[model samples]
Target: MYGAVLADGMGLGKTFQTIASLYSLLTKGINGQPTCRKPLILCPTSLVQNWGKELKLWLGERVVPVVVDDTRADHVKKSFQEFRAFGHGGKPKVLVMSYPCFRMHKAEVYRMGLDVVMCDEAHFLKNGEAQITQAVAGLASAKRRLLMSGTPIQNDLSEFHAVFDLACPGLLGDLKAFNKTYEGPIQRGRDADATEKQVTLGLERMEQLMKLCNKFMLRRTSTVLKALLPAKVEQVMVLEALLKGIKASEPTDKVVLVSNYTEALDVLGGMCASHGWPALRLDGSCSVKQRQALVDTFNSPEHPSFVLLLSSKAGGVGLNIIGANRLVLFDPDWNPANDLQAMARVWREGQRKRVWIYRLLIAGSIEEKVLQRQLAKQGLSKALVDDVGQQVRTFSRDELRSLFRVDPTTPCDTHQAIKCSCSGSLQDLDSCKERAAAAAAAAAEGAGSGAEQQGVLGWAHLARALDSPDPTWQAVSDFVRNNFVTYIFSDHVIGETQHCL
Candidate 1:
């Protein structure tokens, strides 16, 4: 329970902060006990070398680090034994390992107790049932534990509960109690059927939980570094430009083009191939070795590759690709963290040029709704560190419909432009609540035309259904027909096929 989550946003020097704290703790034992304690760092395979490099840059010879080798079982055992042997004497030791290695040899790790256990990119264990989460949670022998992630809660509150349970176990109670106490009411409160009183109670519970969680989590965004960091200009590259296969007009700058789906990567790859652009592609299909090699090549000035085609899931975590100053989000992701992390690859510490982020999205397409969802999610996370006593904003059914109000006549370039701006303080919570209440009331009354209502509510219902734990095709179809057919798609399309749903 002594551990806390350092969830500072990307490009905010989480590694430096962590290293500084560890150096202080290991050098001067807690309460002046003069204890020589060994700590272990668990991170993604892609980040193992990065951790080693950062430790050397920050701490130098003050603390020796042993990077666990997973080439062979014997080699791993030998390295762990040597690491443990250092606990008796010599400079203090810290073991650096990838999650895969830790999962494979968790029993051995438990036997060799640790002073502190730091899990980097901790959101990887957001699935409580995952083997990695189970393994990490089983490390009860560690005296202190820290879970670090820029995005600790990715998709929902359940994921948040998983990481919070790791950092501060039993604080939120078990998963079932947490859902009953907080999640259920909050979710139901978002529905159009919920009463005003129910909504108010749900909002109160959510605020209480956020305030309680914020106490143990230290979060800061790039807003604090606005003056120090160069400008990051974001623009919308319309579907037209993307279909035509746009290229960087400048010759010196390297480009990192990302997509959430691999199909898009393949399409982009074809475009790059047609243009004879020197490029490297990475996705879930690539091995760990291949990914590291591709990253190294992309970062090397000697390489001719200027375009790096990467899938968001593969490149979103623990990557430092500052060699590239330009980024193109070929497609938007439901989880904004993926896009944010991809952008950070180029806009981080070693970057010298003014960063350019082009987010390609079609007007009135699914991407527009996704953008709205991303904004809502961003607002939720921002509320955590915002000053207390301010009203917190949460999504409602009608508000979700409003997100789909994109003008279909306009081209995406003019309609979907994303301007670069510095972060500001949260809006008055009371005003947000009033707006949401009004919108929810409007939605409940079915005030809009059948077409408008269908277009709006159809997408919102689809989003809600997708997020449900046990979504049924039949239920989803009935929802659309009952709520959207008269306003949006006519009965012809709605009743045309059962498989479409």
Candidate 2:
């Protein structure tokens, strides 16, 4: 079975790419059976209709799109029967259903013997233990699997493993083996006390892992597609400066203000509404029906709404509102992908005007730190896909201190790009500590002596000991002596031994 992930940046047409892949497969028979090919696409409930619409628009008359409606139990049962006997009586070649509906009919799905399966916004399956994950994994008959997500690694490398494992199972090895081989070293390299050499080694391991997984994953950023994308002018404006500018703008100006928090949306919406620029707001609470109507109204110039206030998550993916060329990111999110997806709404394919993306930040505030973190994550993503030679740096003390040094009086320099460093969620810090404690326990158990009786020590113990009134280096040597394990993969794979540092 051939499986892969199309992790292109938001608005880069992953939907079209998957469509093209399916078309190619339909023409070029899969495993020498062209007539028996049945492909299944699973997506969020909010996107089921959109998927059907897009499939119809792109592959009209070329392939049949079998859409499952989850509203009626009888209709769902009838659809399941139809899907089980798909291709009979000249039926469609593709079956599209919302993830929720698929869950309800998982048993039927498992029996459908789908030839190919694709999951849009595959990050929903990042949790390996989730019922949906297990259900999707149960499609053992699928010959090919495709996962599409913009933010596959939202929090940690384990999340990356979870997504990649689905695309190419065992390509990253088992989760435990992956953690011991890659996660542990890469994390230790990010430790505050890590030496430059250790960091370099960790990065090299990460690069190797990325290189291995590169075969199954295709990721392209907007920068790479700059020739196709409309020119995007990104500006950084102070929050107060943004307010002043908004106040000066004409009521007819089309704008979309994006924020991570509802409070900011309320404030911006109120300000815009007060200025006679009627505003429409969409957030998590907005229904799928409401979102489509709002997007349509906002996109049409004839509509009364001039300013659309959007919460980042609700507007992130699967919804394309390309009417407004001017957008302001009123606040930043910890994940860079969210911001990227939000900004892509205006800079997409149908956009005729040059897009203006403004990021509003309070000078020297936590917002700046958040932006820095975002830049770092973006750089890391680039290194993994576009440029492996790029250096990925951990947060340094000087960098931390510089976050506070931006002059509040000076207009924030939007033109200057932040030097890219590599980082992810601080949750890894806790995971790293846990790994070290496990290593310590392993050491103590192996020693079988007074090490346990005298009081077992781990990296945390050593970290505390180093800062104590009387620092000790003895534990460091002891730790090294205890947990070290070296082994060659096999006699055939000679001269190289794998061990954790």
Candidate 3:
């Protein structure tokens, strides 16, 4: 019963590592029996071919895997039969399938005695009640299960419970027991107003949970790849004016502008058109063939396109737009995991240039709230996964009271809550979550450039702007100085540090 969750940082090669594991384990038998491990891989529709490719690339002729994604039912059944009756001559039998494909044909293949189940992009099962989760759960006979996700846990512990439940059934007890035990107390302890006792209890429970999970889990960050990766600088700014500033670094440089909404991408596309930047786009409207063609065109390196407009939801997961070294997350998402997944589309294994990430946010608005929630969620994730405990502040309703309340005169609500004003001076720019409320009376009016000024202090592009730097950096600086950027500041440069859980 080897169950594990390989929750490594993206570009750290979780797939390669898992393939190595599969190569080793599939060659052996369980309990001294002649039968080898029968493994089934379930992933997003986009990653089905990727899983097959990785298997071939890694295992080569040593393991021939049958990929069953044909839309035709008879064809799919034939592939399933071949995969099921696959003699253990080629190590153990392997079948690669998309989540939907597996669900559609589970009844025909569930009785095939699948011993090992690997789910890539496992976050798709974050909703415990989703039909996907139930479908994956149908493999009750799988003794060894693996859930692989670079960005696994998202907003709440409930979602964490959902994914972990699929990987290791009773590891956290049933959902109710898990909530009452670890989720309830740890969450109460993380609140801004939690008492000392509650905080201590939360720390203890978090430590206990990680200690238990570590026995069956492994996580590593991009720090391990520090020598291989070039330096990365991430900055944050605001809307349309921000879009107008982006320019390709060189003839080879490419930019990808991502937004969570297709309508938003339409607006951004219009903005790019007005600026005279050559651009291509991919969203829900595009067919699968069209989407891949666009991705290939964008990643052509010598392609004349200056920008690629991406709908975050449509193009986020399992994509490698490595031709672009710079990315702008035009807006925020309720789940930081989605944003993280989109951000990884650029700065990947093939990227040679120093990567730049820019996340846009509106001051004192729902988008700002999303950024705040991202920080809090990352904090909770760190506490759960790392050896050290962090200051936890999961999202709550009290903070949502200031949905649009703007007090331009205060410090970052994030800084004040974390009690670390040192991130940047709060005077120049302020209006994060901590100071989010004031909607009733003596407020509703204003919001910083100390944070505005200092956060970007040593950034090469803007710092050396006088000598003719990136036009985008200079424009962004001017925008911030004039108070055009209402909110700014994120965790830090991603790859240079440990970003996980």
Estimate, for each residue in 357-448, the C-alpha lDDT of model 1 and write its tens digit. Answer: 66766656667778667756654444333322222233456656766465666433111233212111122223323333444454456432
Candidate 3 residues lying further than 4 Å off, grouped into runs, are 28-37, 85-93, 238-249, 289-293, 392-397, 406-472, 475-483, 486-501
Lowest-sum lDDT 10-residue window in model 3: 440-449
Candidate 3 backbone overlaps, count: 12
lDDT of 2 at 109: 79
lDDT of candidates 1 onward, in order:
0.66, 0.65, 0.68
How well is each residue in 1-501 modelled by candidate 2, as lDDT tens digits? 388988887778999998887777767654554633778999876677778778888988887777884557888887667666635456456888888888877997787778789999998888877888888888888858999987776656787888888888778898999999987887666555788887887778888987888788888655445566555655443333344444455334577889888888888877776666677888988876567677878899788776788988776667777878778888888887778778888877777765667676664566767776675565455445444442434455456556656654432221122321212123233433453445446445542111111111211111111221111112233332232211100001011121111
lDDT of 1 at 434: 37
Please report the candidate that would top lDDT against the real structure. Answer: 3
State the displacement of the C-alpha of residue 376, model 1, in Å, after optimal TM-score superposition: 3.7
Clashes of each: 2, 0, 12
Point out where model 2 deviates above 4 Å: 30-36, 69-72, 85-89, 190-193, 238-253, 392-394, 397-501
Index of the highest-TM-score prediction: 3
